[model samples]
Target: MINKIGKITIYVNDQEEAKKFWTEKVGFVVKFEQEMAPGMKWLEVGPSEEEFTTFVLYNKEAMKAQNPSVSVGHPSILLSTTDVEKAYEEMKENGVEVGKLMAMPYGKMFSFNDQDGNNYLLREDK
Candidate 1:
């Protein structure tokens, strides 16, 4: 009964800043954005128009208040890239904090941190 992954929520201190980081720094496009409530806004961003899954940038404080049991910690996300070296260099040029590229049995990969200090893995599938 399971189809495909829909969306992943990323709780951030400032939604606007997160959006900028993803779009400007990470090179993702804004899929959707709208005012959900008085103080809350819904924002969805992804790598491309055809991408099935997207990241929803939500307000951290608002989410925590809405559901105390919900985990607000950073989620580990792994992204695929066509060229690990190019991706790594681009991220570094964009001022993103990234780790050195490593060679694994599977492929080449690296880690980078977003503005919220959330770490994400970038790998070139072999």
Candidate 2:
């Protein structure tokens, strides 16, 4: 039985650039990285090394070449944070493109874009 969600794949134009964006700008750490081919890699990054789930940054062109039917578009991902306001400020200061912070009925939330223009939502968990 499926007990937990594992890794989500994110198709990117440049794996290295995506790694730098997630690690340097978004405060994520590289959980794992392996060279899949001569110039391709299987890269994973997450909020921390201890995080249960990680994002796999796959090369879009290579994926398309392997399977034409596979969607290479970015998925809509929602991430959680302990303090949305602080995270927003930090991400902004780190040169991350962010939207205005909004207070939802549940909590504060905001949207941010990666280097490839893929958008993701960040919400306060508590």
Please name the candidate that would achieve the greatest TM-score relative to the true structure.
Answer: 2
Residue 70's lDDT within candidate 2 is 97
Please, what are the lDDT tens digits per residue for candidate 2 over residues 1-126?
998779999999999999999999998999999998898788999899788899999999999999999989888899999989989999999999999999988889999999999999999996
lDDT of 1 by residue, 1-126 (tens): 999989999999999999999999989999999998899999999999999899999999999899999999988889998899999999999999999899988899999999989999999974
Q: In the order shown, what is each candidate's alpha-carbon RMSD?
A: 0.9, 0.7
Candidate 1 TM-score versus the reference: 0.96
* Global local distance difference test of model 1: 0.94
TM-score of each: 0.96, 0.97
- On the 0 to 100 scale, the lDDT of residue 21 in model 2 is 97
In candidate 1 the C-alpha lDDT for residue 89 amounts to 93
- Clashing pairs for model 2 are none
Error of 2 at 50 (Å): 0.9
lDDT of 2 at 39: 84
Please give the CA lDDT of all the candidate structures: 0.94, 0.93
